[model samples]
Target: MVAVRIAKETGLAIDRVTFKSSLTLDKATLKAVPAGQCVTRVTLEATVYGDVTEEQVTELGEKVHVCCPVAAIFRHLPGCEFEPVWTLAKAE
Candidate 1:
């Protein structure tokens, strides 16, 4: 995924990566709450494995918002709430 690409580019030597995400939206309307908001809340969690530092993981988390086109779109939604969680682990 995006993290893998970034790690390869930055020489992070990643062995594996896992991700979990959740999207919350109004069920009844199934549409924008205030006529511009598409998603209400988005939670994305990434567990990265490599010989990387916590700072590097944090950087990856921040950079995803800038590099991922879909994430960028979600970030701009009028009333959307974005939450990104990053976890780092040693490569096995």
Candidate 2:
């Protein structure tokens, strides 16, 4: 949502945005030990489709990170790591 809004605001010609998520949790937590943060790491791959350049995608990704509230929450949590990967694709 944030990406689309930014694209519209900036006139980036973005047609759509898609993402995939992968998460890792502490082994102890998985074992039901309850001794550490449940989520240890998060990886999000965001693909923006439309007429865009690598620099544009990179800039968009940075802006999204700064604007995304959910990402902010994960960033503030202790022992939790968040990684966001942004890329561009030709609009079909």
Clash tally, candidates in order: 0, 0
How do the residues 1-92 of candidate 1 rate in per-residue lDDT, one tens digit apiece?
77778878878777877888898886766653554454688998888887778898898878776888878777888778988888896545
TM-score of 2: 0.87
Scanning candidate 2 in windows of ten residues, the lowest lDDT window is 28-37
The total of clashing pairs for model 2 equals 0
Q: Report per-prediction Cα RMSD to one decimal.
A: 2.8, 2.3
Best by TM-score: 2
lDDT of 2 at 26: 81
lDDT of 1 at 61: 74
How would you encode candidate 2's per-residue C-alpha lDDT over 30-80 as one tens digit per residue?
777543467889899999998889899999999999989978877876788
Candidate 2, residue 92: Cα displacement in angstroms equals 5.5
Regions more than 4 Å wrong, model 2:
30-36, 90-92
